[model samples]
Target: MPLGTVLVTGGASGLGAAVVDAVAREGGRPVILDRFPTGSGHDEVCVDLVDARAAEEAVREVSQRVGGLDAVVTCAGTDSCGQFGDVGGEDWDRVVKVNLLGTAAVVRAALPDLEARHGRVVTVASTLGLRVLSDATAYCASKFGVIGFSRALAVETQGRIGVTTLVPGGMHTAFFDGRDEQYKPGPDAKLNQPQDVARAVIFALQQPPGCEVRELVITPSVEGSWP
Candidate 1:
């Protein structure tokens, strides 16, 4: 079977954009669900993922327009760095909403279409989800939630839908652009490229029926966060 129609949240940039490009190159139709417009003329549905209902609606919209989905990659994520008590409430809350809740919303919305096609889901998690760091309460909490959620989801939907949780370390993307100097990766930080991690996503999506890549951890050799 072909790659078919796949929905990628946050497909406007970073790892998500890389997956979109890879999916298209492999002959699959990549539908984007993002807050920003791609301007590339690809099939897209622009919506803020923090709004679970709106995210769900966007998935339905894409599924209907594309004639059903074969896969969905929840790559949308955000982080607010600072001491737990230092970060503003809204910023902290937004991290959880966008990372943990948004992932669930998109996947839940895609479940029906995925079940119909025996489709795949690849949810992006972080190394922070496994190891804790100071001043990273919001990001850690949200990513940890993602870890738990994806694991349980895999068991619950076993034999029906393919679920893979991608745990990646720091990457060379704009994900750290607005961070404080202390929070930003150091000048010599060995970060993997977003495209590299994205290839792993394609690998999971391409798994043959009756086979599943349940979880993947892709990080740079000297990744500081993973250890």
Candidate 2:
């Protein structure tokens, strides 16, 4: 089937924005749900994903405006760098709330419409979910949870809807902005671009109805080993 309306969480910037533009380029109406202003002409809904009620309302509003929801791409996430021992309980909780719980809210809110349309759900997880890194406990934990969630959801859908988890290694995004030297990786390290992962999401969405792409792990070609 042809592409239809797509809802993207965190679509205001970074990889989410790339996915939004990709969908638009592919003849799909992009409904962006984000905390910041996307400034894109496509339908935009500004709301905090951490707020369950607000997320639900945003999904409802966007789905209503778009006529129907054909796909969802969740790119809303945050990260912190601190040794497991140094990270405080509150910090861990915050990361989980944003990366895990926030995604849960979006999925819950959009599942009904997706079921009706037999659409796709694409989640932007991290390669950290597959491999552990020092001082990235919270990030790894949340992404791991995302992987598990996607797998379970895929099983529950039973081929009715496409569910995919995108695991990208290092990306040249603002995810490292405002970080201390110790908390950030070397800039020279080869990294994947947001557009690279966006393309993967588009690929997953473009597959035929019966096909499902469960997991995609994308890393920089030059980066032979973990960064």
Candidate 3:
């Protein structure tokens, strides 16, 4: 059977957009939670995921409107690369708020609905989540936090809801568009296509009842981030 309504954070672009398209191709309805509308014809809720309360309310509202949500994909993320002290305090905090707390808020809000439908959640972490690097303090911390959160959540929600932690390496997206030259990957750098990475999410979501994909790591063959 086709998957039911799927809620995707950051569904406006990059990896999330790919997931949205994949869900649609598989005969599922996709709804978006983004700071701006994607114009891809999916119903989109424009709200910053940083506000935990607002994020949760948005999820509830969207879920109600969509009839019910069968899955949630948290692919929204932000990064500010620089020395720990070089980045502004608020700027650094925003990364943590958006990447870590934002992920938690949406999942927490969607839990009741997911439990009702025995739904799945795909939380997007990063290769950085498993390793340390220079000039990416905020991004690293937030993704690492996401990894920890997804693991505990899986344990807590086992036998009820499916939780999958996605450890994705670099992708060819605007995620690096505004980065400083120093932070940008080299021209020859290899990165996975967003669509390819998103397919992993679909695989997790399509698992038969009582089966779950607890963790998945996907990257390019020549990727630098994944060891």
Among the numbered candidates, top lDDT falls to: 3
Which residue pairs overlap in candidate 1's backbone?
none
lDDT of every model, 2 decimals? 0.92, 0.86, 0.93
Cα lDDT tens digits, model 2, 43-62, are 98899866777888889887
lDDT of 1 at 53: 89
lDDT of 2: 0.86
Per-residue lDDT tens digits of candidate 1, residues 1-227? 47899899999999999999999988999999999998967899999977888988888988888888989898899989999889999999999999999999999999998998889999999999999999999999999999999999999999999999999999999999988899888889999999889889999999889999988999999867776
Residue 161's lDDT within candidate 1 is 94
Q: How close is candidate 1 to the true structure, as a TM-score?
A: 0.98
Model 2: how large is the Cα RMSD against the reference? 1.6
> What are the runs in model 1 whose C-alpha is more than 4 Å off?
none
Candidate closer to the true structure by TM-score (higher is better), 2 or 3: 3
Residue-level lDDT for 89 in candidate 2 = 87
Model 1 score (lDDT): 0.92
Query: Count of backbone clashes for each model?
Result: 0, 0, 0
